[model samples]
Target: MEKDKIIKYGSLTLVAIFILSTLSLLFLNSNPSVNPNNSVLQGYVIGYAKISSYDKVVKVQNPTKELEKLLEDLSKNGTIVRSFNFENELVIELKDEKDVYRLNKLFNEYNSSIFADAIIDFENLTFFDDSGKQLSIPNQRKKQKITPLFDIAEPFKIKADAIVGEVSSKEPVVYLLSISLLENEKIQIALKPKNITLISYAISLKIPWDSRSYIYDLSSKLNQSNITNKVNLANYLFFNSTPSNTSLSQLASSNIPFISKITKSTISLNNIQTKKDEINNLLSLYNINVIFPDSSIEIENLDTKNINFIEGLVSNYSNLNISIQKENLVEVEFYQESEYGSTKYVLDEDKLKVRFKTALNPNDIKNISVQAEVVGNKIKDYKIQQEQ
Candidate 1:
């Protein structure tokens, strides 16, 4: 009877351990709040080239109605990325590169009138034409410094020491990421312009999984002359929620009874773009979001639930349906890159990140942070144009 009791207790103990281990993988004590708007393209901005011809020659009779229209229109989607007005000529940088082409065409059509000649270039603040003709602006560039600051709760700051109790990105996930907005969290970054300013900025995020995949970016610009040169978190950081905590490979391995099926479903990519649309579609379907200035992808499905959707895609690359068997390696590494020290390890399934940057001429540019935080990256393109 004692032996039987011991055996029963031992069984119960084992079960308790198993439950705890599983709970560790599935839950967390806290989480960051996610904003649904533009989460995937967080901190992303459009790029455009400027066409130069007229300086302050043609003044805006009413700067409020006409010019402000462009600024207000920016809230929707398309907005001018860069622009400048000098005594010699007026140059405008647009968000979409497509707009640059269209404007250049218009410039040529009206070159004989007052435009002189419209030459399109990626750089802004350009003056001289190729033929040594001068389009001089009397006041070249008035320089000043605009430091953007923020107001937030404790641990966050205009300047502060390393925060305590907060986990580092490098830490492994013992529990599914917390989905709670930390209290006392808010952020602000800004540039106050006294006069006309050409702004270029890119926001960046450190992927909780890895640092090498940092090039993914979303760019934005400041085209307005005196409008505080600021962007709210809404301008750049966008996400509905955090990504999934478990990787496809991890889920497949843990859930599939057949090891072979799990192995087959985790095929690698020759080009990340090949399945861009499909992958992107899956991301949306699963409530995934893409946050930037540092490049990272996020997804929002719980484990084991969406394995079939991915498994089908892997088996048949050409078709919408199928599973894997092409490769023969029994012990293959699914994501070799993860072996390196990446912040986006397994626990980041619920992971999300966002970045912010600011570039203006004096065309010099870059981040301050907080919860619902705003960060910065200084833009260099406009500065390059100034030097040239």
Candidate 2:
């Protein structure tokens, strides 16, 4: 009887063990196990689908090729990881906790090896568990976000101050300058004229100074024929202004009074000014005539014949002094101190004579005078002065 009881108990124990093993296998099948190819996460698994599946999705910005490789590996392993693209961002969806944990582990391992420089950030990696809980990633690192050295508007202010501070000559009460980057990566400098009120507001908002007197002075200075003074005024207006985040091309269309010039980065404004001064000095020293055309010359008052005569005469000499004594007549006197001998030229089929004579002055300066009165395309009265 004792041997029979022992056998019965052993048989019952074996039967119980079989039932428990079968149930365990069924439970495992219901909650799929992920083979993450990792020894540390060997037993880690996902639970069966409940009311809620994925708590949250993972998002990545500016993803690199390594991220693609990681997803490809999981797809090759028969894991269903769905990915959706949204403009610059990539959204990844995992089936359950098992898949999330699997991907998370694989990503960390691959990221450490492939992205040692942290170029592709692991900080963008976010994971969640099956129970609708956020999972913290392991071996995660933080990256420093980059920012601009100065404000966008601050550069314009700084450049304006620097321009104003370098004024060696006359300083305008108010000036404005702007700089912008060109499409070819070149820098464009613009000198713009603004209202005195604008300058007033810029200098002191509390007490807006009436800079009308200064503006009048600047206007009068600009009206003069001196290129040196004009350039100085341009510098005053150009450097004492503001900068803009707007493009240079757009500002050009507004019809605002401004002088813009393109230059290289290696040359400073002071250097530019010095170079211009040196050029002017050289021209003066050599007595070289540089003719700059005037767009504002009025020819409305003169008759066609006089205009033609003046045009013909002026074209002969670049350094001629034009004197319009009357509407019908004009005189052009050009000093050719270096040239000798007499020369003749024809204006509209009218012959003109030139004479060279010594001046009565003590310097013994020779005068070459060309006096002519044409009568029906014929030379009548002509005088030429030569050195004594």
Q: All candidates' TM-scores? A: 0.15, 0.15
In each prediction, how many residue pairs overlap at the backbone (N, C-alpha, C within less than 3 A)? Answer: 46, 10
Question: Each candidate: what lDDT?
Answer: 0.23, 0.26
Query: How do the residues 298-321 of candidate 1 rate in per-residue lDDT, one tens digit apiece?
Result: 222223444455445455565533
Q: Cα deviation in Å at residue 113, candidate 1?
A: 11
lDDT of 2 by residue, 69-143 (tens): 767776676664455453355545455434544554555555421110000111122223234344333322112
Deviation of model 2 at 162, angstroms: 52
